[model samples]
Target: MAEDHRHETHPEIVKRLKRAEGHLRSVVEMIEAGRACLDIAQQLHAVEKAIGQAKKTLIQDHLDHCLDDVVGPLARGQRRAIDEFKEITKYL
Candidate 1:
């Protein structure tokens, strides 16, 4: 494990989660207020998307930074490229 420098993206991920949390709170309120189903669904979708994007970003950032920290030196020594390693992790 590379000296884990996870703090870099943790703040960003937290911010995203906070936004999702607020949206979820609003959604709960909306439900209690008897808001239209469409309105609730849209807000729920927004919350879902925000969380999903945050997860994807967190994973990609970890793979990009930490994987490079661990594999970059070796790949450089072997004259091999590790971009694919980072790029492919985007699907996770």
Candidate 2:
């Protein structure tokens, strides 16, 4: 992934992703250890939420910084492009 220095949230997002990675690993262990399904599901949910938050942060930072830097003043077309990009993030 490309890092944009203008966004201060990059490091925070990385940390969140790392934490999610760890949780996912633990979930694997729980499965191997025959942990209760509910317990494993709960941890998996946490991992999913963490990753989702990281993705949200990344997209928001791109909108807040990258879009602004690339387009000084958004024309109607540019605004439409930006809106489309933001719309795509809704699926994330």
Candidate 3:
């Protein structure tokens, strides 16, 4: 197997996750401060979107680098497995 692609993108991914974490903390603080619902919801939505985008980037980077190297010339069954795995991630 190829070396994990996470090594390449882990720092960037962690930065995104940390930003989302800060956004989440702000959302909690907003709630505690009795901020307007709209403001709180906006921040929460930003947090969710940030985390979602990070997840997508991580998955895409893995597929592009790690899987391409490890699964070169994939057979029929291997391709099906990859497709199914992708399908399952739609819910994420």
All candidates: CA RMSD (Å) = 3.6, 3.4, 4.3
Q: RMSD of model 2, in Å?
A: 3.4
Structure candidate 2, residue pairs in collision: none
Least well predicted 10-residue stretch by lDDT in candidate 3: 3-12
Candidate 3 achieves a global lDDT of 0.84
Off by over 4 Å in 2: 1-6, 74-92
Q: In candidate 3, what are the lDDT values of residues 1-92, reduced to their tens digit?
A: 89643457778889989999999999999999999999999999999988988898788677766776877788887689886776677666
lDDT of 2 by residue, 53-78 (tens): 99898988888778777777878976
- For model 1 the local lDDT of residue 42 reads 98
Candidate 2 is scored at a TM of 0.75
lDDT of 1 by residue, 1-92 (tens): 68755657799899999999999999999999999999999999999999998999888887777676765566354634466666666776
* C-alpha lDDT of residue 31 in model 3: 95
- The collision pairs in model 3 are none
The whole-model C-alpha lDDT of candidate 1 against the native structure comes to 0.84
Off by over 4 Å in 1: 1-5, 76-82
- Collision pairs in model 1: none
Q: Of the candidates shown, which would achieve the greatest lDDT relative to the real structure?
A: 2
